[model samples]
Target chain A: MSSSAHGGAPTGQGRAAALDPKREVQRFDLHQRLQHGLMASSFITLVVTGWPLTTHGIGSSQSLVELFGGMEATALIHRVAGVCMAVAAIYHVAYLGYLARARRLRFSMLPGPKDAADLVGNLMYFLGRQKHRPKFPRYTYFEKFDYWAVFWGVAIMVGSGLLRWYPDATTSIFPPFVYEIGLHAHADEALLASLAIFVWHFYNVHLRPQIFPMSWVFITGRMTVEELKEEHGAEYDEMMSELERSRPKTPAPAGVPAEAPPAPEDAGGAKP
Target chain B: MRVLPPTGPGFFPLLGGKPRATLILTTLLLAPFGTGHASGPASAPTTAPTAGKAGPLPDGALAADGFTGSEKIAPPDADPLRDARWCRLCHDDDHFESSAWRTTAHTEQVCRDCHSGYHFNPHLPAELGPEAATTNEGATPAKRRAAAWATCQPCHKDAVPEEGIRHGLPEPGKPAAENPPTCRDCHGDPHEVLLSKSLPPVERRRKMNDRCVACHGDAERMKAAGLDDHVPAAYGHSVHGRKLDLGGERAPGCVDCHGSHETKDLKDPEVGRATCGECHEHATPDFVTLGDHRPFTLEARPVSFFTLKFFGWLTFLTIFALSMHVLLDVYRSVRVIMAANRNDDTPGGHA
Candidate 1:
C-alpha cells in the first residue's frame, strides 16, 4: 500500500496529493480499541449496579431495586458486574504483559518534568503572564493523568472488591477488623473515584472548549493533524522529522530503468 | 341485818353473806380498765410514720420524743420495736436515725438518697404532675433508678474517677458525678441493700444489664463514654439487643456476657472474644476458628491484622491517588484552554 493510505487522508487525487491531506496517523489498534470498549461497558455496568446501594434512599433507589428485581437481585447484579470487571482486569494485565515482553508497548503517557512545566506554563498563560502556549510531548499532562488514574482506579477497585467478596477466606489469613477497615475504605474510595470520573474526567474530555462535543481520540482512535499539532506540537514535529529521515530516495523518472532500482535486498529491509 | 329468817336456815345462809357481795361489786367496777390493759400499751400513735422511722428500726425504744406518750401499739402479729418507722421515730436524728443513713456510699444521707423527694414511690401513676415527680416518671423503675441515681452528685459531685468508669461496673472511689450509681440504682431497694456478689445469678444479671443501658442508650452519655454514636443504634437494631427488648429468654444482654459487678474493659486482652463467648458460645467459636473479632496487636496477631490493614490502606491510597489524578486532569484541561486563549491573543503563536 502507498504511504498515503496509512499516513494521510484519502482523496481522488494521486498518492502525492493524498500525502498532505491534514490528518494524523492512528494511535490505537484493534486490541486497544476492544480493551477500551470492554472497560467502558463494564465500568458503566458496575456503576449502575453498585451506586443504588450507596445512595440508598426512598426515591430512585426503590425503582432501581425493583428494576433489579429486589435488594437480593441488586446484590446479585453487583456481584456479576464485579466478576465481569475482574475478568476484564485480568485480561488487561495479561495483554499488557504480552505487549511489554514483545517490546510493542511503551508507557508514553507517564508524567514527567514536561508535564509539570506544562502546568505552570499554562497557568501563567491563563493569567495573561505568558505570550505563547507551552509545547507538549506525545501526550499532554491531562491525558497522562487520565491514563494513570484509570490504572490506579482499576487496581484499587478490583483489589478491595475481591477481598470483600471472599471475606471468610481473607479472614482465615488476616484479622477480622482488617476486613471491616477494607470494607470502609473500599466503599468510600469507590465513591470518590466514581465522582471524580463523572465530574472532572468527563468535563475535561467531553465538555471543555473546542472539545465541547467529545474528544474523538478515545472513540475514533485517531486525531487530525491540526489537533495533534495544537495539543502535541513537539511530538508532531519529532514524528515528522523521523518520517522524513526514513523516506526512500526517489529514482530518476523513466530513464535508464532506474539503474536496476538498487537491488531490493540492499534497501533497509522493510518498513514496519 | 335481821336474823328472823332462821327458820329456813340453809337457804338464808349465803343470802346474807357480806364477802361474796363485796367481790362481785369490785369485779364489775374494774372491767373496762382490765380489758384496756390486756390490749398492750395504749399509748402508741398511728399515722404515716416520718421518713426517719418508716423503715426497720435498729433499737427497740422510741428514739424520738414526739411519740413518747402516744402508746406504743405494736400490731398483734408484729413487733412494734422492730418496725422500721418506730426506729426512725426515736432516732429521728438526721445524723443517724434514717435507715439508709448508715449505708457506705451515702452515710448520713437523708430520705432523699436518690428519690429527689418526688415520686418516691416506685408504683406512682405515670401521669402525675411533672414537677411533683422525678424527671423519668414514665420510665421503668429500673431506668428511673439509673437516671436518678446521678442524684448522688449533690454532695459527692465531681467527675467519676477514670479507673472506675472505664468498664461496665463503677470503679472504687468513683466520684458521684462520674460513678453516681444511686443507692437504689444498683442495689434495687433502698431498704433492701445486699452485697452484689450475694445476689442470685439471674437477678444480678438482669439488674446489671438494666443499669448499663441507662447510660449507654443515652446518645450524649455514650459520646462522652468514648464510644461511637452509631454503637447504640447498631446494638438496638442487632438481634441480641432486639431479642432482649422483646423479652426473649435466650437473648444475651449487657450483663449476660459481661460480668454484673465486675465487668471488665473491652481493651483487656483477656476480656475480648473469650468474654463474649461465655454466653455467645456460637459467636465466640466462629470468631476464634475464623480468626475474626479478636483485637489485633502488633506483637500478638501481626500477620493476620497487618495483611488486612495493608490491603485496606492500599485500596484507600490507590483510590485517593486516582481521584487526585482525575482532578489534576481537569485542571490540566482548564490550563490547556487558558494556554490556547493566550496563544490566540499572541501574533504568530500557533503550533
Candidate 2:
C-alpha cells in the first residue's frame, strides 16, 4: 500500500514505482484507522456493560452483573465507556475540521445522486438481471451509511446519556420527563447501533464470502490494487487521468534547430 | 409427645403466625372477653337501638319507619325463617364456639352451605369398632378441610391468589414442604369472621394493618415464601403507613399497595404505575412515562416493550435483507469460480 500522507499516489520517484499494475493502494490513513479503532472498542464496551443494566433483574442480567463484580462496578465500566465514546466523537469532529481546512477533504464519502443509481444497478446485478457490475468510486453507499450511522448514534446516545448520568443536575434545568425521554432515546439508539454494526457492517467488511475469517483493511488501512480495480474502478480511473494531466511535457521552444519563424513585436509572437 | 408452639404468655395459638407483640396487643385489647363479649371500639353498634320489637338492619340502623312513622324499608334478601336451629344444637358453647358465630355476618347462611354433610346424622353408633371410626364415609380430616375450602372459592374468586407467584408453594418434585398462604391465614376462622368495615375507622385501619402484618411481619415466614422479610417494616415506615398511623383516611395501608388477594410481584413495570395511579390518578401517565424506576427492561416498561419490538423487527428485516444480498453475491461468485474451473479443465483453456 502507498505509505504516503493523504492516501494518494506518491509523487515523483515513488509515483513511477506505484505505476505498476499490481501495486497496493492506500485506503484509510493513520488518523482514520485510529478513529475507527477507538469507536469500535468503545462501542463494544458500552454494549457489553450497558445491556445488563438495561435488562436489570433478569436472571441473565443479574448473572452478568455478578460477573462484573455487581451492578456498581458494571455501571462504572459503562460510564467510562460512554466517556470514551464522547471523546472519540469530539476527536472525529476535530479531524473533520482539520481535513476541511486543509482542502484535502474527500467528498466521495458524501451521498449523491449516483448512489441511488448504483444501488439499483448493484441490485439488478445481484438479481442476475445484468452482467456488468456497478462500478463504485472510493466510497460506496453502504460505507457512507456506516460512517454516518456512527455520527448519528453518537449524537443521540451522548446527548441522552448525559441527562441520565447526572439527573440531579439536569432536572434543575430540564423537567424530570426530559431526563426520562433522554434515557429512552439513549438506550434504544444503543441497541440499534449495536445491531447495525454486528450485522450490516460486519457482514460487509468481514463476513462476506471472499473476506470470511476477517478483513485486514481495518488494521492495515490498505487495499490491493486488484481490490481498487474491482471495488473502486472509478476512483482508480480518475486518479490515473489526473496523473496524466499533471505529467511534465517537453516544450516546442526547446528544439529551435531548423528554420523558425520570428515573433513580431505588435502581433502575438510565433515561435518555431 | 406433641411439640408445644414457641409463644409468649397468653399468646393465641389459634392464629398460626401472629407475632408475640401483636398477640400481646390483641390480648390487652380483648381483656373484656371474659365477660362473654368482645368490648372495644368495634363493639358499638353503628346504629341506635330501636324502641320496639324489631330485627337488626343490615346497615345496623333502626328502621326509619319506627321513628318517622313512615312505611318501613324492606329488609335485605336474607330469609329470616331459615332453619339454622340444628346448627345451634351441636354448635352451642357446650360443644363448640357459638358466641362469636351468632354475632358474625354469616348468621344469614345455613350450616349446610359450608358443611355439606351436616344435614344428615353421620355420627357413628357407640358400638362401632375403632377401625370403623377411622374409616367413616366422608369423614377424613383432609376431605373435610378440602370441602370447606372448596365451598369458599365461589364467593372468594381468588381464594389462593397470585397463582403465578405460587405464594410459596413447593417447587414441583421437591421434598421441601411449602407453607402456602391460605384464606384463613388472614381472615381468621370463616365461621366467626368479622368484617374489617364493621369496626370504627381507626380500628378498621388497624385491623387491616394488623391482619396483613400478622403473616408478612414474621421474618422467617416471609423468607420461606421467597418474599422480602423487611416488607412489613418498610410499609410501616413509608408515608402511607405513617399517615395511617396518624389516623389519616387518605393514607393507603398494606392491602391498598399489595392487593389483598391478587398480590403480584411489584417488580412488574405496569404494577408500579397502576398501584400508584389508584391515588394519584392524574400523575399516573407521567409517572409511568418518566422512568422513576431504574434499569427498565423490555418486559417491565411500555416504552421498553415498544422499543424492543421496533428494534427487534428492524433487526430481523435488516439481517434478512442483508443476508439475502450476501447469499446472492456468494452464489454468483461461486458460479463464476466453477465456470472458470471448468474452462481450465477443458483442453486448450489457457490461463
Candidate 3:
C-alpha cells in the first residue's frame, strides 16, 4: 500500500521491472549488490579473454588476438579484470566478516534437511507428481549452490592464478609440476566456471520463461511482498510473525510514539 | 668482387697501444666480402688490405673482429648512430630495424661495424641489395651478408659447443645442405638483431621464439630442411604453448628447451633429458621424451590426460543437469505465472 513502492532504483531495467510491485522485501543490501555487480562484470571479462586463450580460437588465436588489439592488450585486460575479480572476492569476505561481527548474519542461506526436502519436492512438483509446490525459505537450494560455487571457483582461480602470475616465486616454493598443476586447474576451472555462468546462472536469472529477458532483482536488490509470499512462503510467514510480536502493545497514535521500530524483514539491509 | 677499402687517415680512429691490431681486424672483416669464405675456413685472409683500410682501432684490435664472447661495451655519451639519425642520411627507408636496434644492447655499433664491405666509393647494383639468407648462386657463392657473419661470429662463435657445431646446417633462407645457419637467417636482417637485454627475461625469450617460429611455423620452409613441419603447429596446442598464449612469458619457448645454435643437441634424447632437468628438476624420462612439441598425449601423461578428460565431462554434465533443472522449473513456473495473471487482471501482472 506504500505510495513510494518501487519508485526509484538506480539500474535502468524498466522493461522487466514494470511488472514488479513495490520492492518491499530487501533480498540483498547495497554491499551485496556491489559484490554481485563486481563479480558479474569481472566474470564476463575473464570469460571473454579466457576462452580465446584456452581454445586458441580452435586453432589460431590470431583473430581473437586481433579482436582485442593484440596479444599484449588481451593479456593486460585479462589480468586487470582478474585483479578486479580478486578484489571483489576479497571484499565479499570482508562484508561477511562485518555481518558476522554485527551479529546480523543469517543462516537461512546455509543448506539443511529442509533445503534437500524442498529440492526433492520442487522436482516432484515440476514433474506433476506432487500436488503442492515446495515452500522455500530465505534462500533456495539453487541460490546457495550458486553462492558456494562462486566461493569455490574464486579460491581455485585466484590461488592458481597467482602461481602462474609469478611462476619463479611459485617454483621456488613449490615444485615445477605444481605450477603445471596450477595451469590445468586454472584452465579447467575456467571452462567449468564459464559453463556454469552461461548456462546455470544465466538460465536461472535471465533465460527462464517466467523470468525471461532478465531478473532486475539483481540490480534493485529488492522483491515485492507478493513475490516474497509466493516464492519464499516460509520466509514471509517468519517475517509476518516477527512483525506481529514486535507490534506496539498500545493501539492509539496518542498513546504510542509516531516512530516505530523497522519491520523484521528489513533486517536484510536495515538502517543502522 | 668487393669495393676497395677507404684507407684515408680521416677514416682511422685515434689509436692506443694496439695500432696494427685494429688494422688486422678491419682487413679480416674486409676479406670475407671478396675472398674465399664459403670455400675456405672462417678465419681471415693472410694478406692485409690497403693502408687506406687500415685505421687506428679505438676498440681493442680483436673487439671489432672479436664477435665472440659477451663483451658489452657501453655506447658513448653522444653515439651518433645511437638514435639512427646519422644512418638515416642515406638508408632512411628501413627505419624498423634501426628503431629496434636503437633500444637493443648494440646501440653503440655503427652501420659500418657490420657492413665492413660498403665504402666511400660508388657501390655495385649487387652491393646495394639487402643481405638476405638465400641460396648460394652465381660465380660468387657466399651471397649472404658476409659482413654480418663476421660481425656476429666473433662474439657468438663459441655459442655452439665444439661437438654440437653443424657448420653447414642448411638454415631457412639458405636451404642448401652446404650452407650454415647464417646469422641473417635466424636474426632476420643483421640490423634488427635485437640483443633485447633491456627486456624482461621472459620477453627476450618470447622474441627469440619469434625467430624459431618464423622457419618452423612454415611447413614448406621446415620441409625444405628435412625437419618435421608439424612441430611448430603441435607446440601451439601444448601446455607450454597455452601458457605463453595466456601471457605467461616465463613458459618454456623453443630456445628454452632446444638451444639457439646448438639445435643438434635436440637429436640426442639424453641431451633433451638433461636440458629438461635444468629447468624441471623432477622431469621424468618419459616427460623428457615429449620432445620439442608433443607433451599432452595419453602415452606422455596418462594421469594429466585423464584429468583433463574428467574435467571436460564434469563441466558438460553439470551444466547440462543445471540447465535441465532450470528448464523444468521454468516449464512449471510459466503455467503458474499465467494462472496468477489470469486470477489477477492487473496490468502489471507478470507473464
Best by DockQ: 3
Choose the strongest candidate by lDDT. Answer: 3
Q: Residue B281's C-alpha lDDT in candidate 3?
A: 69
State each model's C-alpha RMSD to the native.
20.6, 21.3, 13.1
lDDT of 2 at A113: 89
What is the per-residue lDDT of model 2 for residues B89-205, given as tens digits with 9 covering 90 to 100? Answer: 223342123444556656555555554432121122332333332224444434333443456665665555435433433233322213554455567666667766677665576
Error of 1 at A18 (Å): 7.3
- Candidate 3 reaches a DockQ of 0.17
How much is B50 displaced in model 1, in angstroms? 56
What's the lDDT for residue A45 in model 1?
Answer: 75
Write one digit per residue (lDDT tens) for candidate 2, span A1-272. 11211233433233353354444555666766777777788889889887864554356765776687655576678899889888877777787778778665556667898888888887777666777667776677677777777777788888988876765456556655566567567767777787778876787777765557677777776665555656666766766665556445523233221111111011100000
Worst 10 residues of 1 chain B by lDDT: B1-10
lDDT of 3 at B72: 42
DockQ winner, 2 or 3: 3
lDDT tens digits by residue: candidate 3, A1-272 = 01113533322232223223433555666887787888889888888877777776354565676688666687778899999999988887787678788776666556799988988998988776785667678777777778888888889898988877765566557655666667678899998888788877777667766456776677766666666666677776776665456455533332221112232222122110
Query: Lowest summed-lDDT stretch of 10 residues in model 3 chain B?
Result: B41-50
- Positional deviation of B70 in candidate 3, in angstroms? 56
Candidate 3 per-residue C-alpha lDDT over B69-178 given as tens digits, one digit per residue, 9 for 90 to 100: 31343223322122222233234454334455565445556665555444321223355434422323331224453534445666666763435655333233453433
Error of 3 at A156 (Å): 0.5
- Interface RMSD (Å) of model 1? 8.5
Of the two candidates 1 and 3, the one with more favorable lDDT, higher being better, is 3
